[model samples]
Target: MAAIPKTHRRVVLVRRPPGEPAETDFRVEEVPVPEPRHGEVLVKVLYLSLDPYQRGRMRDAASYAPAVGLNEVMTGGTVGEVVASHNPRFKAGDIVEDRLGWQEYAIGGGPNLRIVDATVAPISTANGVLGMPGMTAYFGLLDVGQPKPGETIIVSAASGAVGQVVGQIGKIMGCRVVGIAGGAKKCGFVTGELGFDACLDYKAETDLDAALRTACPHGIDVYFDNVGGEISDAVLRNINTFGRVALCGSISQYNAATPPMGPRLMGTFVGKRVTARGFIVTDFAERYAPARRQMGEWIRSGRLKYREDVVEGIDKAPRAFIGMLRGENFGKMLVKLA
Candidate 1:
């Protein structure tokens, strides 16, 4: 009913970062709002999900996904409202989720975009708990980590988006869940609020290995790794024989100028019969429907709890993203564009 704006605001990658991404690496500019053609829809982004993985996309180097080219809109996941549509399936005001990047408007759709029910949960959750992060925890832990009841499961970045879900799921599956987080505040939330058996503050402790040993006396049967640097090295040292590790992220190394050097894990893997596998959420795309149903039930029943740190405005996305990289966000980091 309202007239659509001719131009919209967006953040573009102006320069590739040599290391940790600076706000200057990105530039906010006003661009023409694209029109949708046949089989397409025009979306007005409401929430932009800021994640650690976006850092990898800033590099020109090859990765699982293509890099964000210089002067191009920065790549990101977003929850948006359909403002216009040429596609029969979508209509104006319909909420949807897609990789629409750091922009106010997008003009595309297909398998990459899906309509989401705002009534089921907060539409913003399509970017966090009920979306990629939730699915990542579900499959990464259940399919990859496979914790048996009474076993010990330790998750790095335990109070984070994927980490929080992984720890909660481990507990639900009857495992002794121990979380490794950065500070006392996050550590407290992980244990007291999220119901993890124990949470170690890696930032406060001088000897992470000792704290891990004390917390996981039975040895870690499953390690859901998010922060993959020295923390991963410490976790590997405490794994039980035939332990399983689900590698969801490597946030600590995402901004590194060079490959991070750490203790050789091959020997430990061989001696402990550890099974570690890296995975992306898309690998289990076909099963997202069932996973979402289950996660929704968990949320409704209060068995699973989640937190989101939302920054207002699209202009703040760069700063919020950088903060997430520094472990400054207690949970999922998101930018509210609307």
Candidate 2:
């Protein structure tokens, strides 16, 4: 057998984000893969997810979860094939989802892993559509957005993993789905591929209010906001009475050099009687099976579509990660390790 690399091929937190992350923020190193102890399994990672939420992790500031430790591997969800196991519950060929952070291999303890089926969808979907981001879109939009018949549902970052699913699901639920994305390509994908009723290119919209007013002529019933700041402000201005807003993420503020601003129309809630709630996906982990069943069925029926911008090598993980934050990725950003 070939000898394993002595160092881990992983990305470390070289420095915390000043605004957004830069190349220097991550350092690559090789470290020995640890051996599995009792009740533990050693996995060789195959796919690593790069999500916008990771932007928040780069900051030392506290949020729903702790920041990635300084000088440590950046944290993320991953799919890996078990290579060695001291755990009786898992075999060497079993694939599992792990919070393995960023590394080529990981040794994790019991009760922290879930066996995965590579045939269910794709192994990557465990980190994309059926993963944490997928669950976030599901609970946040349906549970909080509460879209209704004949109502308008708007989502920003509309062509991303979560946003794309959100828009398509909104359409299936009988709402007029409108999407806001950064460019024409993404704008096209949201409306054309994902089946949103309308898409507004944030880059091309000269008068966002005018554009929003035109698309949401019936008034907004639900707004699933992933990109906060100005786009959020525009959506807030059009809220119908009893509308709902699901505060999913704020990609706009993730890499800011300074503090960012939220929708200036904070008072709209009072006028419209709109309800806005913030959530972390883990809150609904118990419901993941139900949500995945629905999502999978939709995919099989062609009602839901998914995409991934997969980078082939582990070394390029950092660059692909930064690009996702910049809206360079058209779908879920994934690092293929195998």
Candidate maximizing TM-score: 1
lDDT of 1 by residue, 67-166 (tens): 9999999999999999999999899989999899999999867877999987778998899999999999999999999889999999999989899999
Which window of 10 residues has the lowest lDDT sum in candidate 1?
104-113
Give the alpha-carbon lDDT of every model: 0.92, 0.86
In model 1, the clashing pairs are: none
Q: Report the number of the highest-lDDT candidate.
A: 1
Q: Which residue runs does candidate 1 get wrong by more than 4 Å?
A: none
TM-score of 1: 0.98
